[model samples]
Target: GRKRTFLACVTWFSVLMVLCAAAPGPEFFAVVRFLAGIGLGGVMPLAAAFTTEFAPRDRAAVAYVIMQSGYPVGGVAASLLAKWIIPEFSWHWMYLIAALPLITVLPAAWRWLPESAEEQSVAASREERRDAARAGLRAIFAPGIRTTTVMFWVMSFCSLLFVYGANTWLPTLMQDDGRGFSSSLNFLLCFNLGAIVGGIAAGWAADRWGSKIVVTASFLVGALAVLAFSGADGTALLLVLAAVAGYGAVATQTLINGWVTRSYPAQARTTGVGWSLGIGRIGGIVGPSVTGWIVSATSGGTAAFLLFAAVGVVGALVAGVVRHAAR
Candidate 1:
């Protein structure tokens, strides 16, 4: 069933991406992009749940983190692709490039991806499926788990806020810090490169130690990076800070996702991960907008970085407070 849902979401996202490429006007493009967001949103938690289900119990967190690394990897790829494609072809071609997953990943996934045992059981009985769904929802809120769920939600919100806000504003912030135009862009690249490396590192560390301490430390590391960014003087130092910030923000999100996968059982995994992400998506929506306002109001100074760094602290505290999984 999750395989079916994953395939449907891929199809939905791919089709909408195609529509976005062919959009006639700004309004049409906006509407189609919003619809595509729905597809993109569904793909994430489902993928996380799927990864956790198939991975060995002890290795699930690492596997999920490795999978999550693809997000930043994709970001790096897009940045490179855009650099090449936009000059030669156009922006529309970029969307067309995104739509290629329809022909590539979709068909490959359909051919190779297997449904989990849990999914197969539900598929055989509709009443059992309904009961499982209800049970999963119930389990997330049951007693000891409810507090963990809420704290996870808060951590997700703060992590996403750090992620989106930094990714959207890092370039501008770098420029404000006196870097040249090209160097500003380079910082963004370093940032994502950091995320790619940091995510994998955090993953292995999480598998070795556990998600709780690793996630907490990673968030604090990111906050320090963000705070140090305000006073960064040399280009080399600024770039290093950017990379660290990326590690702190992006990799922490990866760890959080992994923790969710390791925390919930197969029956409730998707529901738990999906709702946490659903709430985090709201923070994602707010992040860029709030940063834009801060930039406009404060001119992307120390105050902006301070505020974001504070959010990172909040995320660390929230992660620290998440109790052991109830079930």
Candidate 2:
């Protein structure tokens, strides 16, 4: 059933994200993105859970960041396609061509994916597993950690809200400030370019400075960048601000994920990270929806940007206040 679940979700995930290949127009593309977001909502967090679960304990943070770094890498690829592929062929081709890799990944997953060794061992040792499972549940709620977990959850919620909101609306936000469609597209490219750099920088900084410090600063900087973008109507200025926003929002999120991975031992790491993501997805769901509403209601994207910028502030404060609860 685990394999079946993985197969089903992965298949849908791959199919959905790439289906933009066939999109007819703006409305259809938006619908495709919606459906793809649904599949992605399932696959991405689970993939992170698996990576952290199997990684060596000492290097779980590195493993988590490295695994998740694919997110921004993919963003960079999409931005490149928007530049080169879309012009050469179409956005449809861009999506379809990128899906080519799944030809290998799907079959490899089917043939080789297995429960991690620890999970397999837990399956074999029933009594020990029962005991460990109970303690794992308790560990999350035992005083200090309970506070940290709650703070982490709140921070995750706010961070994702900011990430998804800007990611979905940044183009429109730029255009609303009088930039042409071309400049808006260029902003997306610069934003994702910033994301790729942010991913690398976050990993390096987290390792040297600690996930908490990196995450806190990421949120803080992201907040300022986003707030500043409201006034950055100049094309070059806006592009630079977009990159800062990407660094702050996207990089901060990966570091928070790394934090979740590091906070718990192997026994509960999957549950910890998975649940944190699951619950935080409340914000993920709300983000784009609310942004759409605000943009429509106000007839501009300025309000949406400011609202989400304030969300970045909340995330920064939460990350700053939480005491580390690693066990």
Candidate 3:
């Protein structure tokens, strides 16, 4: 229900953008963008929950990897489509073209996806629903869970800070470091390619060993990669480090989500995952702001890289505590 509501709102807002953009005014475009952002904010967590719920027990990690890869794959497709269309059609047509996939997918989603079984079960029992809701709130503060919750929160903060900050500003950083446009785009492609590989590999490792070890190693290695990337002066080295960081950075969240799903029972899994991501969104906001400030205050690329690398280290340490708590 909530997810559907979010999608409806986004669809409406997307239409508004088209109409507003047609008018050609900054304020209108700004308002439309804000609306679009609200829609985006609601979709991601819901999608994560949906993925976990639908995924089979044995292949949960693989499911997450495949589901998360959609973002990069869609991005690549959109870029190609835009390149082909933008020369012949107006920019508005590009937006319209993007809407085609949503039209096809939304109908399939409406027909196929099941309501969350946990939610449905809760609804069937009024007393149980109340008790469960109370317990859900208390679980985050319970003796066994309090530390785990805090650890995950800290991990989320650092992980998102690095992920969003690096992705948002890295291209500009590359250009500042004297790389050409083609080289920077190549770096992005390499980075996303690594992400696809990393997601699958991390999932397999987590399922085989444990989410803890996979997450911890990912953060530590990711931190090192980011630090090395800070001094990358050559195109080859920069692309290599970007790919490594992408592998580590992108897979960290998937592993963390898997951990969350396994740590809590099905009844509260959605709440746990939702709350963690909600908290992490704050980090997502802070990352870009902090990076922008660092760029203004110092050398843009290097300072931002160092800040993100430091964040990765903090995430690695916190993830250890989370692993302990889970055990």
Instruction: Report the number of the highest-TM-score candidate.
Output: 1
- Better model by TM-score, 1 or 2? 1
lDDT of 2 by residue, 1-327 (tens): 234555666677568657677776789888877776666566665666677667776666667777787876777667666767766776677667656546856798878877667656555576776776676677766776888888888988998888778878887777777776667778877777776787677777777677877888888888888888876656788789888898887778888887886787666665567667777888887999999999899998778878877898889888888887444
TM-score of each model, in listed order: 0.95, 0.82, 0.85
Q: Which stretches of candidate 1 lie over 4 Å from their true place?
A: 176-181
TM-score between candidate 1 and the true structure: 0.95
| Model 3 regions more than 4 Å off | 1-27, 78-101, 125-135, 323-327
Better of 1 and 3 by TM-score: 1
Question: lDDT values of the candidates?
Answer: 0.85, 0.75, 0.72
Write the candidate numbers in order of decreasing TM-score. 1, 3, 2
Task: State the weakest 10-residue window (summed lDDT) of model 2.
Answer: 1-10
For 1-327, candidate 3 gives per-residue lDDT tens digits of 435654675576556556554647778767776666665656555666677777887777778777877665654465455555756785666656645535765666677767776666655576876777677667666777877877887777788787778777776777777776555556667676777788788888876777777888999888889899877667778788888888777768767766775566556665677678778878988998899899989966777878877888888888776644332
Give the lDDT ranking, best first. Answer: 1, 2, 3
What's the lDDT for candidate 2? 0.75
Model 1, position 174, has a per-residue lDDT of: 71
Clashes found in each candidate (C-alpha, N, C closer than 3 A): 0, 0, 0
